[model samples]
Target chain A: MDVRFSPEQQALRDSAAQAVDRLGPHTVRDLEDTERAAKLDAAVEASGWRELRAAGEGRAPLASAVEAAIIAEEMGRGLADAPFVGATLAAELRRLVGAPPATARETVGFVADLSAPAVADRGTLPAGAVAIDARHSASALVLVPVEGGHAVAEVSLDASIPAEVDLTRPAATIAAGAGMERLGPVEQPLTADDLRRWTALGLGLTSADLVGVMRGVLSVACEYAGARRQYGVAIGSFQAVQHMLADACVAMEGSRSVALHAAWAVDALAAEEALAATAMAKAYCSRAARMVCETGIQVHGGIGNTWDCMAHVYLRRALLAIDVLGGAGANLQRVLDHNGIGGADGLR
Target chain B: MDFGDSPEEADFRRRLRDWLRDNNPGLPASSTSDAYWAGQAPWHQALYDAGFFGMSWPKDIGGQGLPSVYEVIVDAELARAGAPPRPSLGYLVVGIGHHASDDVKQRFLPGLVNGRDRWCQGFSEPDAGSDLASLRTRAELDGDEYVITGHKVWTSYSDAADWCLLLARTDPDVPKHRGLSAFAVPMRQPGIEQRPLKMINGVTREFGEVLFDGARVPAANMIGQPGEGWRLAMTVVSHEREPGELGYVARYSKVVSELGRQVKADPGKFGPEQVRDLGWAMIEAEMLRLHVSRRLSDRMDGISHGPEGSVDKLLMTAVEQAVGHAALSVGGTPHGDGDDMWLKVYLYSRAQSVMGGTSQIQRNLVASRILGLPAS
Candidate 1:
């Protein structure tokens, strides 16, 4: 019944936190714009993070979920241009698709076909199968081969990468070569359990980052409020400022808890359990982060809105996080679908 | 992490279901009003007399003393049986039976458990809903008694309540939150007035407002130390909401299944995404139920309810609201019994996020307490 992070897990989170702190958000931002899509190989190789990616194949999915969460949080906090999309997501997918060759590095794709390709069997092929565009050289078109392609894995564009505000981790449109040809039929679409695991991993990382961003925003707001005077007294002394800061504090904590719970669920429970918790975490924390950080900018008033102000960084990151991993609405729909609740009125 | 209830719980649920099926005095369908508060007091008392109410309260306090989860079980059964809700604030908020002082507990608890008296909370005011500490309702000491004067709003069933577990400010200047006290004031006492407050469903008055123009009550009526009103109120507020998305999930599942049938019956009645929406909500229900059950279990084992409660509140509210809207969408013109149910749920569901705590407050709780983030 009790849920507390194991000392080892706590250590893992702390380590990630420390690393991000040392690297700092500015350094990460710098790296993002300069390196963009090319940073993935270098980032993975330099941080010894490649080992973490490799470990997922042999480790428990829960353990991988936890580690991913920790790393994501750190990266999010630092706003680091690390390849979370390629490394974390690809790692999990590889595990689900079963172990791949050591030389293989997996990346997912979503094809948008304006013209519905005439298939030999419309009844047999799954609805959402589009071609995989190559952002990375190693990227490939993935098919879970179900009902002989009549029904298949639900796929969408992985926006966490190239669409990232930080250009370093920009999602590259990779070309699919031999990997594109290796398609198989999926008997079961990505299960609720699998989505839960991936989602837990996504939420944990995102929440941690959101918390970090909020912390940065709050620090800046507090400083300005203390130094900025109104009616000859520090603005920080004002009740309005205090209340705003307090609210931000609350939001930051909420995001943190969601991330922690999501991580814990992924590690301790089945994938479906993890998915639900993660979805809750993602939905709540993202909205909270936006509110808290926006307030941070508001408290700073004119100063916070400047391009140079770090508050905007937090704001941008929050926006990116919401869309990166499918957004709150999408995850919620996933939850509903998994439970066998269909028809327009069923959810009500 | 294990969200499923124990086998014993399953068996107990089954027994409860079977018993209700055999013995439930089913209410006439037309009699089930939105403000359906119409059971005989003695009939309500009979359950506690037979040891059915307060299953988790201490045995010394006239309960079965089972695990807290059993209370959830009992609530589920009661709702399923469509039995009238027993007057609860007296037992749930005030101590059941002899838990309060011998005289106080004995006088009020038995009456409440046995349904002779109904209780309503007297906490919120004009300025205090989510920000409850700002309430200006005052009660000054008058020798061995306290004279209370203030207005209370959003008191559920206050008009019908025989007693109120009320909070009043005893000192105005010390601090905004401190110097407040809680008293169990008899609603029928002098200088007390109650008026009904309409809910979204205009047909029902499930709540009311109470005004006290110098209402006086004995000093012994206080629940705890004089200045401990904040703590007492805090404890009670946290307990007001809990897990049971299972019922909502079940209800939503029924909606989705029925929709599939309806749509299949009439192709033009539902859109394509409408069917998906129902399915998605059902999936989410299962997911939310699992997470919420795990959280409840964690809390029952003495762990902090943590930010997980906020997460559950947020998800549950979204599901309830979404399901409500979905039902309305599918029901088309909002007519007939289905539309009526849809409208009632849609209106009530709005409170899911705001009632226990606002979604905004929940987000703040998560951000500050759980994450090591600075207060923004």
Candidate 2:
């Protein structure tokens, strides 16, 4: 079977790369440039990439999950401090239950350690709920108990507090018992199958972003190795440095390959199969990203700990990406559940 | 991009599955046993007879003249059916077909591919294991033949081999990398000695050390130019090193699933941590499968195999060890269970990191050749 990207996918990737290069942050200071951040947000909005999963003919997605993942990866590579992942997940939720798109910007709310979608009972959210990457959003979607299963609802966003660990994105908390209004009803309610498919999409995107993080950090480390010389030789000439970079490169490629396969499986396989693939991809990427990112920092020597170097930027973005949907441990647990280990029904 | 078999490929796969089921050979479980080693040749011949072996070679070489994907299907199905792993003689095929003259191919390939003439590699000597360029095997040209004198170790299947696709230094004055030549020497000829070594797993007849004293070879057997030996050896090594070429993903997948079955059979026997370790092993296996699928896709798109195979080798070692460790902690005892064979797998897994090429050498190759890092 052919795994090479089609010409159209290649064209999309090229355009995404071009956009990131133009509007992406170049220095650590660029993260503080509100003017550049606004422009980046506008460019992403104008591109309509966030709505790629919006309903189309026959209630299908406008584009494939692979296309959405391509955009996410490019955003991650540039460390573009924009509102893509949140806005995109918000669109995915609307499309899942056949709800019309909200007039204002929106993202999905998360509960339970900020890993899964927040669930509301009778249009009321529990305390400690937060909306991730809700920088410019006006509302956030939360799931509500329905007749057959669940339905989508939205609660207004006041403002985002600065996220502590991950500097790239902003997170906002919803007060306990915050009111959420149900979206206008359609013929179908969301089922467990629907949520599983949505989780697959979320996991696939995060895995892609983690792959991008590895790629970006490894590039930074390699350049540093080639330039930073000691005792009249580039550090890259040292076997110790070369081997570290090489190991990172290998792990990064493995993550990319598995992530691509998971993205493809979203449209090609059944919902359960897609979820399993995404969980495995997420596990692989999550485990590799931290070690690979550390290798980048290690190669940079002392400057890596300071705010000036870009290695911290990559690592920060990666930690957030790793936590989205699930980290390495959570994803491995998902795999175990899917395989029926420790499950009530026992083996398949 | 798609990763499923085409209609024709699906059909070939179905046929092979049926064949394996109908012609299953019940061999002894212990690979160290004489009965098991005796069973290997017959299995190889049966696969050849059924057109499941060498499906990728040209028609003139007694192959089906199919794409390499067919061979991949055969490998996967063999693993799925609990048969022996696919024979790894693609190296020998690559060494002879790519560098040898037409007459050489016509003389050796037909028999080699069909299991009529078994061959082993005589490349790694005592001092040349990882640093193959430093080999001291010598071959001096006479009127119509070359007289070879050298010692080669770690030659797999040398005892059963009808010929040894040997590498020797034909010009000592030139640089080591430039002075070498390859020969398809007769294994049973005079001045040749084969001493099969017992591996740590207690497997005999699978590997050997050979000594040569003026072993004569026809001058026509010299493959390519005098200095092309290094290139040919690299080519040969890459064939087996690639996960795509060897279908290593399918082999690992089979083992991982088997381990899963064992854990499921008696979940109480394993701790939660052990089960999670099994899950980790499962994902690692899947990672290799995905990586190999992408590499195969690249190969189908006409990208040639090269130094990147070192990446595949490294990943394979990691995955295999992960699976082996899972097997040991979850199901294996100090002594292996006959039905499960967990400890046997664990022991063999350690050998993989060192065989064919050591993991250190693979990283060195990747660093220097792929990453443009300076070599010491």
Candidate 3:
């Protein structure tokens, strides 16, 4: 399984990293209130990553998805708060559900506004148009029927908001019926195949985030161990400290391999293999991210928990990612269902 | 990169599983007193006769000389079968007698493989557990023999062991980890005392603290060079910790599967939580199996048993604790249904995370060695 990215993908990742580097260290520490959100948005525009990554030519949607994953990792490393993740999810959804309307824009959000009076707000409403704010940042609302639901909309959107912990990236909530146009009726619920695709996409992205967090945390830890001296010796020499750091490294590596293999399997169209791989990756990466972040904090001691410390940012991100997407158990159930094992009749 | 067993491995596993089914006693259907151990000796001998006992050992040394991965596959099958752990001491402490001298190999390995002898490790002491090298057990060399005198605690099955693999300090003032030697001491000899220690389960299972007062053994009994005991002990410890109940996981899976069938047949009695817990235990077992399999592949590829082994150890112990907790929760009491499958499993699972090395210690190893973090 040669899981290395294509040259184009690698170039994209490298570009993202360079763009992230422009933000400088301690930028993440500086993000506070509205300024942080604005900086993240600015960085996204500057990178052109959204357009470049989405447009890359690759037969494998999974591999193309991984290109976005790479971008996510870099964004995470920079602690860029822009909705790159949300944007990437939008792009993938567009690809999956067919191109959005030429004028459509997507932003992922929770708490979609559902109480808007059809006749009261926002210009002439097209017959049954319901203004739905999926992206808090979107200029326009995606209007679909109350009965249509969001999963099967056509005419690609510019922005789409996602709900909390939804494995398949959905958009965030916006003003109810504030800005959407009418689409056709809901065509389908997520089929098993659809769930499989959704799981890979979510898991792949989260796994990438985990790898980035781990890398960032480990780098800080190693730097701390090397620089921080006590008792006339670098604390790194002490067995107690060394073991903690070592565990984080090991977990990080395990998570990376699992994630890569899962992504690779998806690209290869090995569905059963991808299911198992993604489950193992998500489960292990979540655990690893937690382990590494905690160890990072422990290694840094009192300072690690402070607001100014970089470790705390990674720790929070790790916690959020681990809980996002319904967690390891949900993924395992997916795997169990896909593989037809471990359940009655081996089919759920 | 490949997780599936190779064709050869698959065939070997199938043969071993089939052989075990035919030769091993009936499914440990009940918590039949000693039914597990009762079948161990004969089964070990049968495996030895079939040349399947020590695939990792060199043929000249009475092993089949196959890659050690085969041993892992074999043990994995045996574990899945619910067969007793037959070579715990031999494969672990003795490592198929790899450290044993030619004479030692000739004398002890055949009997060990054939189940004519049982071996127990004597490492932990009242004062030394995690800081194992600080053990106070001393062995003073006297001409062709070494006079051993020290007290060893937490010696598993010492009372029943034909011989004890004891580590003793041969030098007084060197570093703590160094200056130690491993000896194969006969348990039946004079100057040896064994006092059974009751465990939390209330059954001794031959657990004991052994006292060696001037126990003499020829220097020939030493596994390797005089000061090589530390290395040997570490090797044995890694092996013991690395496998982490692969076979027991397999066997228990079967038992649990059977139990699930019975529960399903009488669903009126078991609730969703009980069923869910059982399902979780099964999933936990699979996770443990995958981790161990990866480690086994790494080991066979000559990768050092590094901090990753500690991860396995931690997971194993945690799963064991979780399984035990689930069993106890389901059974509604400690040691419920004296012969209840849940209770026995729960009781035994407690030992998994504690032995080899405590889960906390393994975590420490991971933090320092794998993550390269600063110690607190």
Candidate 4:
């Protein structure tokens, strides 16, 4: 099977990179530029990237999962501080349940611990439910249990919630019993398979983000290694620093390869198979991203620890992405359970 | 990008699975016994006879001239069915295929493809394990023959190989890397000696040492021009470390699967930490599978990976060692019927980082060559 992107896909990736580079933060202080953030949010909406999964006339996704993941990764690499994952996942949910796409930007609400989606009750959202990547979004998507399956629901996203660890994208927990509304005239109810496919996309997108974060941070670290000198030579000249950066590069490459496969699987393989692939990618990317980000900080030595350095921004973004769908530990368990690892009958 | 098989690949894979289901010779677990080694020879021949081997080699060399993905399918299916491993002599195939003369290729490749000409490599010496350019293996020109004299350690298939693709110093005055040349020496010739060496896991036939007072080969048997041995060695060495060349991902998958089976059969036998370790190892194995798939895909897309193969090598070592440790941790006490296999795996996994090139060497190559870090 071919894993290399087609020319169109490459063009999409390049375009996404250019957009992020043009509008994303250049320094931690840039996060305070509310006008720039609004511009980026508007630019992202205008790009129609948030609706990549919106149903076309044929009732299929406008673009494949790989394209959406490419946007997520580029956003992550440039620390684009905009709502992509949540918006894209919200669109995927709507497509799966045959609901009309959101008129405005939409994000998703995850339970407080961020293990799974928050299930909304009759016209109400739960307390301590986190809405991810919802800075400029009007509403966050939730699940409403209906006859035989779940129906698509939306709850208002409170943009005024307290700030979180990730300075780029905003993750806010809603108040208890917040008002909600279910999307209507449902052509199809969301089944277990539908949810599985959505979760696979979520996992794949987050994994791609982690790959981007690792690559971005490693690039910063390598540049620093070449410029920062100690003992009359660049610190990169030392095998210790070079080896550390090299290890980070390897981990990032490994994370990238698996993440790409996971993204491809979301559209190409069966739901169960795709879920397995995404779970593996999530585990690998989560672990490697954390290590690579730490290596980035380590390579910078003292400055890496300060708020001024960009390495921490990558680390912060990576932590949120790693834990968004499932982190190393959670995804590992999902894979094990999927494989029936501790079952009475296994390996058949 | 797609990960699914084409129709032809799917059909071939299905037939290969059917063949394996009917004819799988499930040999004994890893052992030092000649019986274990003997079993592999027939298995290799059976696979080649069924046209499952040499799928990526040129057609003139008895291959199907198909892309490498077909071979990957064979590898994965073989591991899935618990069948014997395909003979992992891709380094030799690459060395001879890329460098040997036309006559040499026509003479040796066909036999090599179907397992008629069993071969081993004589590259590593006791003093030249990682610093291979420093090898003192001498091949002096004597009439129309080169008399080779050297000692090689950790030589695979030493006891049974009919031919040995070896490296020796041909010009002592030149630079170490340039003075060396490659030779295809007959293993049964006079002044050649083989001594089997037992591994930590008790596998003897898999490794051995070779001593040569003067193993003679015709001057025409040199694989390439004299003093090009280092380049050829680099090619073979890089191929040796590649995961696809040895079908290592499939083996890792099998290891992870068996471990999962063990935990399932007796869930209470493992603690939470041990189970976590097993899960992590499974993820690592899956990562390598995905990584190798991408590499194969790149190959299919006419993309050649150079020093980036080092990245795969480091990842391979990590996966191997992680699986080994996980298997040992899960298989408590190592006293059950197949527990020794876990111990063997753990021991052998240590060699993955050390063999081909030490993980340290791999990191060095990646740092200096790929990352462009200054040498210090």
Kindly provide the TM-score of model 3 when superposed on the true structure, using C-alpha atoms.
Answer: 0.71
Model 1: residues >4 Å from true position, as ranges? A1-4, A24-67, A97-164, A173-325, A328-348, B1-35, B39-59, B62-117, B123-153, B168-180, B188-194, B203-205, B210-219, B226-341, B344-376
Give the alpha carbon lDDT tens digit for every residue of A85-162 in model 2: 888888888888999876898898988477788898655676677888888887899898888988888887767878
Candidate 1 vs candidate 2: the DockQ winner is: 2
Clashes of each: 60, 0, 73, 0
Scanning candidate 2 chain A in windows of ten residues, the lowest lDDT window is A339-348
The full ranking of all candidates by lDDT, starting with the best, is: 4, 2, 3, 1
What's model 4's lDDT at B271?
A: 72
Can you write out model 3's per-residue Cα lDDT over B1-376, one digit (the tens) per residue? 4444678878888888888877765535222234545455666677788767767666764668776556557656766676654455433434526576777778777666566788788888999888889999999989999999999998977767888888999988899888988888889999999998876654465468999999998888887887788888887776677654234445544544555555556656666556556555555555565555555555565666556767666666655665665566555453443545566667777777677877667767776666555555
Task: Report the C-alpha lDDT of model 2 over B170-286, residue by residue, as the tens digit.
Answer: 989988898889988998999999998987666777789999998999988887777789989989888768776665665677777777887778877777778877888999988
Q: Quote the lDDT for A287 in model 4.
A: 91
Candidate 4 per-residue C-alpha lDDT over B130-156 given as tens digits, one digit per residue, 9 for 90 to 100: 899999989999999999888999998
Compared with the real two-chain complex, what DockQ does model 3 have?
0.16
TM-score of each: 0.66, 0.95, 0.71, 0.96
Model 2: CA > 4 A from native = A175-177, A343-348, B26-37, B64-72, B335-340, B374-376
Give the Å error, residue A326, model 1.
Answer: 3.6
DockQ of each: 0.09, 0.57, 0.16, 0.62
How high is the lDDT of residue B305 in model 1?
35
Per-residue lDDT of A1-348 in model 4, one digit per residue for the tens? 667899999999998898888898988899999888888878887888988988887778999999999998999898988889988999899888888878887789988767788887665556678888877777888998888789988877666465566888877666456667888767988998888899999999999998888878987888888889999999998988888988999999999988999999998888988898899999899999999999999999999999999999999899889888779877887888888774433221
DockQ of candidate 2, scored on C-alphas against the true complex (2 decimals): 0.57
Give a tens-digit lDDT track for model 1, residues B1-376. 2323578778877877776676555432211243344443444566676556666555654666666555556555655566543334422433223224566666666555556677888989877898898888888889998898999998876867888988899888778778777888989988999988766745344678899998988998877777778877765654554443223433444444444456557756666566655544444444444444445444465664345555555566666666656555654545554446545545665766777678777656544454333354
